[model samples]
Target: MTLILAHRGYSAEYPENTMLAFREAAKAGADGLELDVQMTKDGELVVIHDEKVDRTTDGTGFVKDYQLKDLLKLDARFKFASLPNREPIPLLKEVLEWLAGTDLICNIELKNTLFMYEGMEEKVIEMVREFRLTDRIIISSFNHYSIVKSYMLAPEIEIAPLLSDGLYMPWIYAQSIRAKGFHPHWRAAQDEIVISSLDSGVEVRPYTVNKDNELERFFRVNCSAVITDDPVNARLIREKTKQA
Candidate 1:
């Protein structure tokens, strides 16, 4: 059966990457959680999707500009005004502490593609190891070099490359980089790509798979997992496809 990973943690309903979102995703029965990680000005690993907080929070400017203390003051409940609580941007350590208590797998996307934060991989890997959650963590990045560096640092943990465009024979590319999995755009994860990759023991997990048809298709094909904003709906669809 295909696993359901909540993209940014049930983001379709809650603010993306918030603790509230992650908690809700767990309650919704997602098999895992997918989140983005970027370093702060003070060298703290914080979880947020964008380099800038303008889109996701009430703050302006880049995340790297703010120290973790200052960044926590901003409300992360962007566009969710009726949510009835101020959602502070969570520290990666805080999230990991929370995750250590749960059985859900975590796909931590290193948000270092745009700004190559020095020592970002080392910091993230060290934190994961500190929590003893290396086995349950999958470190991914759009920066393939960052992914390679992560793999070299901790080969025991699973590492996947995030691809926005179609990469021909992604499994082969992944092997070249020593990646154990592939996280591609849903469109890039074609039937042949998915099936062949899985057959060769490479995990194929597509991102932002929200539509019912797409959910059913990936589930039916038995891909490793689907990273989705609507994990609740995806879980239901997975059950339905399994029954069919």
Candidate 2:
């Protein structure tokens, strides 16, 4: 079956990258959940989508500048301009614990900037091992060192390289890092690129592909998965496509 990975846990319905959101996505029958992680000032792995907390939380500061205690104090709201009571930022451990027995797979995207977290890669892998979720998790990152170090730390865990702007020949980079998959932007999902990744035997799952035509193109080329904001609509599309 074509995999329907929920982007930030059905972000269209709830706050992105929250435990509540992930739980809802699993309940909605999403095959997988994609989440982003960044290290707090105290060197703890926290689930969040942005580099700064100002956009999603009531607090105003870079995540790396605040300790985990401070981050927990802030309200991780949805639609910051509208509903400020949605949810709070969830720790990566919280997610691993919640997904212990569930069938949902995880795609962990590490948000590493220049400031660098001390042993961040090892810390994430240790959590995955403690939870015995190495096989169920796929680590990804825009930072090559983070993902590459993850591979060095735990070679058994699957890794995907997220390609966004101006990344031509991503398959070569993926191969260099021994990545199992390639996650490119929706606009970068060309047939040739898809075919090339397939030829290289790497899974090519594009992000935030919500358009009908884009979804159709994904299915037409048999891409590995589609990370989308609308799990309900994607699930319906998957079901109808199967019936067809």
Candidate 3:
């Protein structure tokens, strides 16, 4: 069966990266949780998916511009639809602390380039080591420099280079950085491209897959895994589809 990795926790059930969302994802039996990170102005590694806070939270500014203390004050909600007491944006350490002694895997994707956090690669590596999760963590980034910098700093953490349409032959690019896997947007997973990566011993897992038919297509072609926004639905589909 294809491994089902949750994209930013069970984002559909709770706000992405919030403690509630991550707990929901773990409860849903996700094989791994994928989250994004950005360094705050005060040098704390915060778990958030955007450069700015306006969209996902009740705030309006770049995350880089705010100190971690200020960022915590904003309400992180999925609109006003969530249960009144459901969640808040969780610190990366808080997530790690929660994950301690559990078997859930994690993939932490860097939202900004290495330049944004200067020495962020080392900082992230240090945290993963501090948490003693080197074997279970996959560090990834859409920015090519972040990918390369991560590989240079911590080869122990599995690296996956995320690519969108802007880049072609991304398999080659991933290999150049010694990436353990290739995480491309589902639309970018052309047949030859996936096969080329697989042939080179690099697994390819497409991101944010939402439909059964689309997932079946990739599975038929031997793609490694599917990162999804709804892991509970994906797991059900995977079980039923396999039986079919």
**Alpha carbon lDDT at 91, candidate 2:** 95
Q: Go through the candidates in order and give the clash count of each.
A: 0, 0, 0
lDDT of 2 by residue, 15-77 (tens): 888887898899898999999998898888999988888887788988998888878987876
- RMSD to native for every prediction? 0.6, 2.0, 1.9
Off by over 4 Å in 1: none
Top model number, lDDT: 1
Per-candidate TM vs. native?
Answer: 0.99, 0.93, 0.92
- The lDDT of each candidate is 0.94, 0.86, 0.82
Which of the two, 1 or 2, has more lDDT?
A: 1
Looking at candidate 2, what is the lDDT of residue 199? 90
Worst 10 residues of 2 by lDDT: 77-86
Candidate 3 residue 28 Cα shift, in angstroms, is 0.6
Choose 1 or 3, whichever is better by TM-score.
1
How far is 142's C-alpha from truth in model 1 (Å)? 0.6
lDDT (C-alpha) at residue 112 in model 1 = 92
